[model samples]
Target: MEAENKKLDQFTKEVIQDAGLATPSVDFLANVMAEVSKEKVPVKVYKPLINKVGWLIIGTLFLIFSFVLTRFSLGFSILGDWDLSSLMLEKHEINVDIPITYAYCFFFLLIFVIIQITMISKRFSRSLEN
Candidate 1:
């Protein structure tokens, strides 16, 4: 029995030695890296309801409207009781006096609108490029 066990162990060892070490192909790493670096299909992400150009136009219109409203509300008198022909004929001198707080608020709103417009346009351009 002991001789038979020894012979079986020797046979198993010889079989394992004959198999030797298994290795991957030489280009295995390069092939994996190439697959990892391959470009994928770009996906379009929807963000806002309006497009960049639409937002820009809307911002511009809002800016103009706000300026006109502010000017009129601040001091510029509307044609209330003056006849248009008489007012046009006479040399009219208009004076505009803007308070510091109002001026600051208007400027802040203007800056905010400009920044929003710029960001929207930039995002739109980037999306187009992708």
Candidate 2:
């Protein structure tokens, strides 16, 4: 049996050698590389929701608000005796009594939100690949 198997293997090898190996075109490597290079991989551009101009506007508004709040607090009205009482909330009337259970619930909610965001991002990325 062993002699027969050896003879068969030798015959198969001889036949394969006589069949000759396939030869690629002269510029096969170059052509493949060129094709690979030509392939367009979609790229996601990074664009902030708030641009520099938007940030500048927001910062200017914040500064203006701070200035107004400061002047109003010190009895120095920038609006010339304009009642700024509406802008300032009365501290005495405000009473908040939140339960510890609410804090735990909010904490759990935050964890769930973070997990969901990660899962959603991964799913979107995988979908884009296909």
Candidate 3:
């Protein structure tokens, strides 16, 4: 059984070699030089201005949503009404200024506007420079 298995392995290797499917010879130095040459040249991909503007707007909207969700989680707490003096506490009180959601949304909207303005100004400056 062992001899038969060895013969089968030898036959398989010979068949693969005869099919011109043998492993390639190493060209280590040549491959390195080719890769180095490729690195020296920069590859450019062009995107239309409209597409980029669309993506920027979408990202700004997502940022605004996340800010609102975070504020909503932090500002609201609920508990059942119970006798205040039951636990022998002298006084109990809760103070909330404003709905956190509105404040957070407004703040982030302001920031998003500022960033957009800055980016636009910079882009215009670069265009003028060229």
Candidate 4:
């Protein structure tokens, strides 16, 4: 027990000495407390009508943004076709604009994202109802 006590005392003393070496001035702590005390508490802004309108605008923007993005992305294949021409698999120039593959992929991803968001929204709405 005495040996353990001596080891613990030595460790504690070492930690204290190390901490003391890195200690900030008392004035720094005083200034920090003063600054904290001078700061104002943040106010929560609430306007039910404005909030509803804001959300409507945001929802509209998201829908339009998704529509435009999907439209462009579906047309992405025309910019540059992947060079599958190296091997004896037959060199072919792909015209992306008429291709249905990009359209299919775009629709699939959009559907998946919409379904996931709908599920989450539904779950939250259900919880709110309960």
Ranking by lDDT: 2, 1, 4, 3
Give the Å shift of residue 6 in candidate 1: 58
Consecutive 10-residue window with the lowest summed lDDT within model 3: 82-91
lDDT (tens digit, per residue) of candidate 1 on 31-115: 9989988968787765678989999999999998766654444333475654334343235666779999999999999999999
lDDT agreement with native, every candidate? 0.80, 0.84, 0.71, 0.72
Cα lDDT of model 2 by residue, 1-130, tens digit: 9999999999999999999999999999999999999999887654679999999999999999876774456566668876655555563377798899999999999999999999998888777666
Top candidate on TM-score is: 2
TM-score of 3: 0.26
Task: Return the TM-score for each candidate structure.
Answer: 0.33, 0.46, 0.26, 0.28
Residue 96 error for model 2, in Å?
39
Report the error of model 3 at residue 91, Å.
Answer: 32
- Clash count per candidate: 0, 0, 0, 0
Residue 96 displacement (Å), model 1: 2.1
Better of 3 and 4 by lDDT: 4
Which ten residues in a row are the worst by lDDT in model 4? Answer: 82-91
- List the pairs of residues colliding in candidate 4: none
Q: For candidate 4, lDDT tens digit of each residue in 10-93?
A: 999999988786667879989999999999876554335658779999999998876655444443444385322232223445
Q: Candidate order by TM-score, highest to lowest?
A: 2, 1, 4, 3
Q: Would you list the clashing residue pairs of candidate 2?
A: none
Tell me each candidate's RMSD, in Å, in order: 10.9, 13.1, 17.1, 17.5
lDDT of 1 at 41: 72
